[model samples]
Target chain A: MEHILTAFGDILFHPTVLLFLVFGVVVGLIVGALPGLNDTITLAVLIPITFAMDPKYAFMLLVGVYTSACYGGSIPAILLKIPGTASSVVTTLDGYPMTQRGESGKAIGISTTSSVFGGLSSSLVLMFLAPILASYALKFGPPEYFALAILGLSTVAGMSGDNVLKSLIVCVIGLIISTVGMSPQTGYPRYTFGNDYLLEGLPFVPMLIGLFGVTSVFEVAEGLKSRVKDGTFAKMTVPRIGKVLPDLAMVKRLLPTWITSSAIGNLIGVIPGAGMIMAIYMAYDQAIRANKDKKFGTGVPEGIAAPEAANNAVVASSMVPLMSLGVPGNSTSALFLGALMIQGLRPGPSLFQDAPEVAYIIIVGFFVANLIMGPVGILIAKFLSGIIFRIPRETLTAAIALLCVTGAFAVGNSIFNVWIMLIFGILGYVFNKLKLPHSPLILAVILGSMMERGLYQSMVLSKGSLMIFLTRPISLVMLAASVFFAGAPLFSMARNRLKKRAKRGAIS
Target chain B: MKTWKVDIILAAALIVISVVSFSDSRNYPDIASHFPVRLSIVLGILALVLLVKSLIKRREEAMFTLTGEQFRVIVVVVAAVALYTTLLGHLGYLSSSFLLMIGMMTILGFRKKTVMVVTALCTVAVVYAAFNLILGVPLPQDFFMAK
Candidate 1:
């Protein structure tokens, strides 16, 4: 505790850290405000910038971006019907409706307040929980770690959302993509296509930029041709700071939702493959189900609070895996891990003892980032909302394309990477056009490599017995949950059909 | 013409990819082939499912079709990237990057000569200053390295 306080004081006093935090917030806001720009892409692009800074400051920048981007996404979602990021998709339900009702100010105000609350609460939890979890995680061996990885894979079934078959297909594809690089256990190349550049495998950052950024540009360009011409800009009026406080009734209503969602978020976050978006959506679903009388998606504060809290909570808890086990739970966290590696710091159980001050600084930085997001979000909301909407669509598309191309090339200074980006961009576009969910594909891509690595390692350890997964307690539990997740939807559909048939028979 | 056609195409692509991947996996030892073989099997199964489903449900849903203008815009952007790749080794990172940005901006209908030149110069200067000078990361040198 004393060390933590000292670390907090150090971070507070460090001029470099403060500057990085401010820079991160600004960059995060820009990325989050722009449609199709996401936290992962922002982190990936800013990675090259971090090579010059101290690792502590570099991580501070990433933490700030992660927190602020969540808040920044709400700006566009409130002002425009379009969600700036996937997590903000639900925010659009009431956010845009509030805008259309000429209360964009109130909506943005509430969103800012709720986002800060969620972020701060989660950050506090992260600061306290990470070290404890790391200590416990130290006890894990190869078998335990393998079981945990399988547990994480099981979440893919739940995340697939009404499409088990498609999700499984996506998971398989992701595994394939992950195997493209050299086999880690053995030094043999797997799918290098006879090119020396391919020996290093597909770069994560370029592929991510292509999937999220470049594909987004094409989608936006398609939308631009027949653009919705609603020129009504709401008069910007921020609610007084005092007015942003939660009332007794509001607090009482939101407390359960916040607690429940945050817990769910943290649990899902610790498991790789189930990202914040999934955590948020699952929490939202649970909240709605539990509070059946309350009409969600109708500007209810609880509705907003649940997902906001859950997503932000996941942001911190997602670090649990990365810090404890050296496995990144999501793309943004993966980038953070990359930054840590670049700084000559390896993340695993020993990090807590070996570098307690750095860990403390990161935890403290998360808190500071959450605190900064509220005021910055409110200050920039009105100015940015209008400016972003008015930016010529053609120019935005062109800039995005340019950024994507440059970013792809810069990943490894390989032109081949640029080609990969284009290939993925086209795949993304086609998937979008076909109304197929790209999240599963993206998630599959991210997890695919890890899954292959884990499965191979486990098989080697178990001497080729596929029953190893079932024999392990943790893996068995996770597999059981996956079965439940997969079966529950089918059961629900069947039940609904039977009810409809019964009603029709009664009428006859 | 139908949803089945799209499904067939995707399925065929998946099949080809799986087959190629399986044959390729044979080169690696058994330890390495384990994961790829499993993945190929999964891919083959998914392709079969998709093909069957597409055949079963032949009706097409209304889809968003891109206009010629939009297609042209995308084509120009793609071409700009291709041009950048072709020229980067020869012209170097800074010069090639500048040309790519200017070419893309122009292709996207930014006709102001001053704006184009300014945007090009500023982008190159900033990117160069940030990546090269501040970060100490080396950029592609092209003929400049020889000099």
Candidate 2:
């Protein structure tokens, strides 16, 4: 506790770190406000900037970016009817409607409040819980990591949209792509096609940019051609700060949704590959199911609170695996681990013991970033909200295209990476057009490599015995949870079908 | 062609990739081949299932076909990238990148000649500043470096 407080004091007093945090927040907000630009892209671009800075300052910057980007995404979603990131998709349902009604200000305000609240609540949890969780996570062996990977892959089934089979296929394809490098166990190359670049395997950031950014750009272009010119954008009013805060009744209504969704988010986030998007969607679904009187997708406070709280909560909990076991839960956290590596810090049990101050600083920094996000979000909301809406479609598309191209190229400084990005872009477009979920594909890709590595290591360690996963209590519990979660949709679908048939019989 | 045709084409491509990947796995030892071989097999199975489903269903839906103009734009962009890659070793990063950006902007229908020139120049300058000055990462200088 003393160490944590001292770390906090140091971070507060450090001018350089504070400046980087503010700069990161500003950059993150701008990137997140821009339609088609996401937190991943922002982080990727900022990575170049971080190459020269100290790891502690660099990570502080990234933490700021990560926290604020979530808040920034809601701005465009509220104003432009376009989600800045996949996790913000639910925000658009009510956010856009509010914009159309000329209540853009009110919508932005509520979004800002909820976003800050969600982020702060999660950061607090992270500050208190991460150290304790790290202690437990230190006990995990290869078997536990392998089980966790399987649990991560299981999320693909849950996030497969409507078609579980198609999602599985995409997941399989992703797993294949993940295997396209040198084998960890034997040091033998697999599927490298004699290319030197392939020996290092497919880079994740470039793949993500192609999958999310470039593909979305194509879709945006398509939509631009058909979209009606609604001059309703010009006259949109920004709501005052007072009007945006939820009334007493609204707060009461949203409290359960917020708490429940945050809990769900934290739980799911502890499991690898269950990302913020899934957390947000599941929270939204739960909130809607629970609300009997209020119709969701109608600017209801609970609808906003549920997803916002859930996504943000997942942000902190996603760090549990990364900090404890040196296994990243999601892409952002994976990048965070990479940043730690670049700083010569190996994230494991030893990190807490060796550099308790650094660990505590990062945990406390989350709390500070969250607190800063609220006021920053409100101050910038009115100015940025209007300006972003006014950005010409042509310029927006071109700038994004350029960013995607350069960002993808910069990932590894290889033209082959550029080609890969373009290929994934087309693949992403095809998946989007076909109503196939890309989340499962991405999650599979990320987890697939780790799963293979973990499984092989565990097998070698245990002398080919498959019983290791069952023998480890932590691994066993995670695997059981994965099975239960995977089975949930089937039961729900069955019940829904049965209800529909009964309704039809009653009508007859 | 219908959406199912696209699905069939994708399935066929998957099968080919999987087969090639499986064959390539032969060089690796048992432990090394384990993951890739398993992945290839799973991919093959999935592709086969997709092929069978496509054949059985024969479902037709309006495919989101690209317009000829859109097709032309994409082709030009790809061609520009190819040109950039092919010339990179010989022409160097700065010259090749500038040419690529200009060509892409023109192909994408940015009509103003000045806009194209400005965009190309600014892109190269900014990228150069970022890589060379800021990050201090070396770029391919080709013949100039030897001199």
* Candidate whose DockQ is highest: 1
List chain A TM-scores, every candidate, in order: 0.69, 0.72
Displacement of the residue A72 alpha carbon in candidate 2, Å: 6.6
Range of the 10 consecutive residues with the lowest summed lDDT in candidate 1 chain A? A228-237
lDDT of 1 at A65: 90
True contacts kept of 2: 0.29
Model 1, position A377, has a per-residue lDDT of: 76
Candidate 2 TM-score over all chains jointly: 0.74
Residue A384 alpha-carbon offset, candidate 2, angstroms = 5.3
lDDT score for residue A339 of model 2: 77
